[model samples]
Target: MKKTILLLSVLFLLISCGKAKNKAILQGKVENEQIAIVSKIPGKIVQLLVKEGDFVKKGDTLAILDIPEVDAKKSQAEGAVISAKAQYSMAVKGATENQLKQLEAKKMGLKEQYEFAKKSINRLSNMLKDSLVSQQTFDETFAKYQGAQAQYNAVLAEIDEARKGARIEQQTMALGQQDRAYGALQEVETANKERYVIAPQDMSIETITLNLGELALPGYTLFNGYISNSTYFRFTIPESQLSSLKKGQEISVGIPNSDKKIKGKITIIKQLGAYGNIATAYPDYELQESLFELRISPLDLDEAKDLITKTTVTLSL
Candidate 1:
């Protein structure tokens, strides 16, 4: 009777093992979206605003860098803008008061010479008719008068030019220079702004790689963190289970050791290639020869928001 009892116990154990092997429950993990914050400009970290594990909001000031080069560039740009503006103003306005005064004085001198020549020509004409002055003398006097008139006209043109403002093309060229300088100033200012590292989105600080007074290089990661909204679930399912699953199909996700249940949608299903090695994310599961991946996004994100990455969870068929 004791031998029979032992045999019954062995048989029961074998049956339980077989049933456990045939179970279809899969193990998956919650995948959190992680990112590395990097700096575009290289400089010494002057201030660190956030500590590890601190929650940061979008557009939060993460750190400040001391970049002397950027400061110098900003000053240079400011000077260039000032110079351009002065040039533009000069182009728009005519000559100075002193220049106008000098031009008028020269015009007056020419007018006086013209008047003197005219009087001489009149006197010479009267003398020539009276035969007192030779014909050649009268002709010379007439030429002097013509020369004086030409000189006076040239001076008048000069005065007009000095009074008028700059030409349209000149003004346009100065305006272009001013615009280009302004654009450069804006560019430098933007670069200076980048020296202060700002958080791109809401996330938790995982690790701060650099400390105050440490040199930060361009494109070097300063902080490693995770975005809250990018969390998802990844699972590897056997080929036999792929037939029941499809993209955009609604499925149930359950947490072990907890009563939490979340509705997830099948966002991706990829079959492995022939002779391909299965890249299992969760090492707790025994991998099969023919495997497919099922990537699911939670429909109720708030329900699964607290789940950490790599924590095993169950997926319902």
Candidate 2:
């Protein structure tokens, strides 16, 4: 009778242990999609439109930067554009009426000089033939006539060029310069618009890294927060028990100290590195086993929107 009682007690203890192990619960944390809002240009924070914990929507103005450099650059660009436009106009149009008149007057003066030099050279040639003038005198007069003739021809050519427009190649080059200047102006304008930092998406602001009047560098994150309607559950399970869960499987997660349960689908099951931290303080599996991360997305995102991030949640295997 004594032996039989001992055997019954042992059997009861064994059964209880098996039941406790089968009902093991895994602890996970609630997480949300996060983002960092950064600046593309360096500037000082002149005005902060939003504060921490403020909810913002897409296209909303979050902050305003005072970029004095942008203003100066814009002025310079405008000047460049005006200068380029004038050059382009000059190339397309011929010389002005005043300029043509000046060229014509100069041509008339050169023509008179050319005629006088021609007469002088003819007289000197005759004198040289009659031995009245030296050969040096005749040569000097000939040279003066040649110079006057060249000057008259050059002025005529200049007047003709003024009548017609600039060469096609010159016009093309001027147009290219004008385009380059315009492009620079556009670039400066785009940078000027960056002074108003706008929100890219709807989100809740968790942190403000800079204060008013602080300098924000390029690519520096000014705000950090979670995206709206992006709550999910994260769990770390050892490889020994990985077979119990699969991607796309539906599961129910429980909130600690609350009766509310969330229905979610396993979206990802990825292996974690050896140095990665496990969510649960005491994992059930052996230490030698590899760890894996399980991400479960809620069926109804609205239901999980109010869930606090990094809060403890429970899941049964």
Candidate 3:
């Protein structure tokens, strides 16, 4: 009976253990920071500043492109700024007195001719009223008077426009065109700076895909650099056992066959990709499927630097 009792207890513990959950371990690559230097515009790579394994700091120039066209556009933009300023100055300073004098003289000459034509037309009209002038002569004089009046009015309008000074509206439009051209030039300069690739931050230069004199196209990738200081673990997980792990939960990581474990905090779990269904053992839980990536930072992981890029480790339950 004692033997039978022991067997019953052992079966009880085994059955209870079957109800517990275990998360499966998934493998993932370790990456901290990767800065990819890509071509901003299509052009031949005129200069390559750093080699593979070269160290770089933030904003350090690495590569350059051969784009004379970009340079030319920048020069044209500078010219536009100067042109706008000149126009602005001219508009502020009104036409000179000498200019006004010449306009007045022209207007007076037109007025004198107009007055003479008006008197001739009126005299002929009176003659027509009394049957003294022929219809043809009266008509000709009337036409001449109309032409003179039109000429006088045109002269008066010109003189008035000059006295009014240069129009601010016209000047504003001209200045705006110049400003837009300059703005386009600034954009080209920004793209040109990228031609000389700069380090986004202090990083370990990883790979150099091309050497000097390579024809680089827009969006062509040349190098991959990783940040030197920031380190984190990447975990790949299967569809099943994902729910067993949650962000903010503490995890135990240990070397293979070792009893010592280091604590790590889970930071991110991907909601997409491979996934598993909720435990069917619980009748009330909804069934869902998805894949995920887990990220964690180790506690007191100063020694983690040496173990970084480690291939073997187990996730403890």
Expressed as tens digits, the lDDT of each residue in 118-211 for candidate 2 is 9999889889999999999899889999999999999988877777878899989999999999999999999999999898999999999999
lDDT: which is higher, 2 or 3? 2
- Quote each prediction's TM-score: 0.73, 0.85, 0.58
Worst lDDT window (10 residues) for model 1? 275-284
Runs off by more than 4 Å, candidate 3? 1-29, 94-164, 235-246, 255-262, 269-294, 300-302, 306-317
- Candidate 3 per-residue lDDT, tens place, 1-317, comes to 99999999999998667644333333343436466878777666778778877778888887877777777877877777677666655555555689789888988998999999999998888899999989998998889899999999998887776667567886676667667766876787786676677777887677887877777777878788767665566655545666588889988666555576567789888754423321111221124644456677777656455554534565544
For each candidate, the alpha-carbon lDDT, in order, equals 0.85, 0.90, 0.69
Which one is best on TM-score? 2
Q: Which candidate tops lDDT? A: 2
Worst 10 residues of 3 by lDDT: 277-286
Model 1 residue 206 CA deviation (Å) reads 2.1
The residue pairs in collision within model 2 are none
Q: Which lDDT value does model 1 have at 312?
A: 84
Error of 2 at 271 (Å): 1.6
Model 2 Cα shift for residue 265 (angstroms): 0.6
